[model samples]
Target: MEWVLLVIAGLCSGIIGALVGLGGGVILVPVIVYLGSVGLLDGITPQTVVGLSVIMMIFTGLSSTIAYMKKKTVDFKSGWIFFAGSAPGTILGAFVNRGLDLPSFQLYFGIMMVFLSLLLLIRKHLKPVHWFVKNGRKTTFEDGTGTYVYGYPIWFALLLTFGIGFSSGLFGIGGGSMLVPAMLLLFLFPPHVAVGTSMFMVFLSALVNSVTHISLGNVPWLYTIPVIPAAYIGAKIGAYLNHRLNSDSLVIVLQIVLLLLGVRSILDGIM
Candidate 1:
C-alpha cells in the first residue's frame, strides 16, 4: 500500500515536471502529508515525511536530468559553479527540516511557493541588460562576440546558487521554482535553457543529498522507484511542448498549480 501511494506520487510529480521543469514539490509534498498522515505509515511524523520526500526527490531529479541533458539545454558552467555552495547548503537544509515542526513546515513551504511562483511570473517580463566593467567603460553585458554572458564571471551568481540549493534541500525539491526564475531574472538565461540547466543541477545535487537521506533512513525507495520511467518521459515531452505552447499561458498555469499545492500542503499540515 505504501509502495502504491509512492508510485502515484511519482507519476503525478512526473506529469507536472513535464510541464513546469519541477519534480512537483508543491503537489507531492502535500499529497504525501495527506496520504501518509492518516495512519498510512507507522511512526508518521513531519520529519519522516520530509525525509522520505527528499529521498524520492533524488530519483525524480535523476530521471529528468537525463532528458534535459539530451536536449542540450543544460548550462553546466553556471550549475557547477553554483553547486560549490549549493551542495553544502542542501546538506544543511536537510538537517533543518529534520528538526522542524509539521505545521510550520507546511506554512512556510506554502508561503515560499507563492513567493517563488509570483517571482517566476515577473521574471518573464524582465529585459536583459548590458554589462559594465569596473573600468567604467560602456561595455556590453555580453562578450565581444555579442553572445550572452555564458561564461561571464559573476561573483554574485554563487550566492544566488547557494540560496537556491538551500531552498531545494530544505523543501525536498529540485528548486526549479526558485532556480528557473532566479536564473532567468539574474543570469538572463533563456527560459528553455534555464529549465534544462536547472534540471541538471537538480539531478546531481539531489543525488548527493539522497545519500544522506538514505543514511538517515528518510527516503522511501518503494515509493520513489516506480516514477522513474514516467519522469523521464515527462521531461522530454515538456521540453518538446516548450516549442509548441505559448509560454505565457503555460507559466500562468504552472503558477496556479504550484500556489494551490503549496496552500493545500499548509492546510493539511495545520490539522
Candidate 2:
C-alpha cells in the first residue's frame, strides 16, 4: 500500500521534472520530508532523500537524453566543459552536505530552489530579440538580456555556465533548470535544443554527482530503485510532448508553472 503511494508520487514527480528540465530533486525533497513527518517514509531522512533523488535522476537523464538525441539537440562541446568542473565540486559538496542538520539542509535547498523558480518566471517574459548564425553554425537565438549585438559576451556565457555547474555540484542536480534558461537568454540556444542539450549536460553532471554521493556514503538505494523506472517513463512522455508543442508561448507557460512549483516546493521544505 505504501509502495503504491510512493510509486504514484514518483511518477508525478518524473513528469514534472521532465517537462521542466529539472532533476526533480526539488519536488522530491519536499515530498520526502513531508513523508518523513507523517511517518510515511519509515524513518528516511531528508539527506537520504537527496542522495536517492540523485541516483534516480540518472535514469531520468538517460531517458530524456535518448529522446533529445533523436532530434540531434545535444550540444556536447559546451556540456563537457561544465561537466569537467562539476565532477570534483560535487564530491566536495557531498562531504560538506553531510554535516548539516535536516532543517539547515532543507533551508538552504529551499532558498536555492526559490531563486531558481523566480528566474524561470523572469525568463518567460524576456523576449528573444536577436538571432545569430555565424560560419553557418547552428542558429543561436539570444534573448534581450545583453547589449552586445553578438548576443551575450563570451565571458558572460562562460560565467553563467560555471554558475550552473556550481549549482549542480552543490545540490546533486543536473543544473538543467538553470542551464536551459541561461542558454535561452544568454547563449540564444533554441528552446528545444536548449532543453535537449541541457539534459545531456545534466546527464553528465548527474553521473558525476551520483558517483560522488555514492562514494561519500550518501546514496539511499532502497527508495531510488522504486523511483527511477517511473522517472524514465515520464521523461519519454515529456519528450513526446515537447515535439508536439511547438509554440514559444507554450514553453513560456510551462516554464512559468514549473517556476511556481519550484517556489512552492522550496517553501514547503523550509516551513
Candidate 3:
C-alpha cells in the first residue's frame, strides 16, 4: 500500500513537473520527506530522498523532453548553451550536498521560491526593457509550428545557468524551477519553448547528478524502482497538457505551485 501511494505521488509529480518544467523532485522530495518523518518510509534519510527523487527525475525529464520534441517546442540551441555551464555545476553540487543542513536548505529554498513568485506576479508592471534584451545578436529558433526570434546576452545566461546547476545538484530539484523562469523572463523565450527547453536541460543535468548519487550509494533502489513507470506515463500526459495551455495560463500554473510549495517549505523549516 505504501508502494501504491508512492506510485501515485510519482504520477502526480511527473505530470506537474513536465507541465512547468520544474521536474518531479520539487513535489517528490516533500512527499518522501513527509513519509519518512512519519516512519511510513523506513530507512530513508534526506540524502536518500534527494538521491531517489533525482533518479526519478531522470525518467520524468527524459519522458517529457521527448514529448516536447515531438511537438517541436524544444529550443535545442539555447538548451545546449546553458547546459555547458549546468553540467559542471551539477557534478560539483552533488559533491557539496553532504555538507548542508536540511533545515537551512529548506529555509533558503523557500525564500528563493517566494522571491521568484513575486517577480512573476509583478512582471507586467516592470519595464519590459529591464527584463528583455535591448540589443544583442538576434537568434531565430524554428520549431515545427513556426519560428521564434529573440535576443539575449549569451554570457549572462551561461553564468546564471552555472548557479542554477549548482542548486539543482545540491537539492535534486532538476533546476527547472529556476531555468524555466530565467528563460521566459530574462531570455524572453516563448512560453512553449521555455518549458520544452527547460526539460531538455534538466534531463542532461539530472543524468549527471544521478550518476554521482548512484556512485555514492545515496539512491534507494527498492524505494525508487516502483515509481518509474507511473512517472513516465504522467510526463507524457503533462507534455500534452502543456501544449494545450496558452502563455498566461502557463504562468498562472507555475506561479501557484511556486507560492504553495514555497510557503510549505518555509513553514516546515521554521517548525
Indicate which candidate wins on TM-score.
Answer: 3
Query: What's model 2's TM-score?
Result: 0.81
lDDT per residue (tens digit) for residues 164-184 in model 1: 777777877667667666666
Per-prediction TM-score to the true structure, in the order listed: 0.81, 0.81, 0.88
Candidate 3 residues 95-122, lDDT tens each? 8877756676667667766876776677
Is candidate 1 or 2 superior in lDDT?
2
Which candidate's lDDT is highest?
3
* Candidate 1 off by > 4 Å: 1-5, 38-44, 127-152, 268-271
lDDT per residue as tens, model 2, 78-182: 566546655565656666777767666666676776677677667868976444223113433334443222234444445566666656655655677777776
Which 10-residue window in model 2 sums to the lowest lDDT? 132-141
Number of backbone-clashing residue pairs for each candidate, in the order shown:
2, 1, 0
Order by TM-score, highest first: 3, 1, 2
lDDT of 2: 0.66
Better of 1 and 2 by TM-score: 1
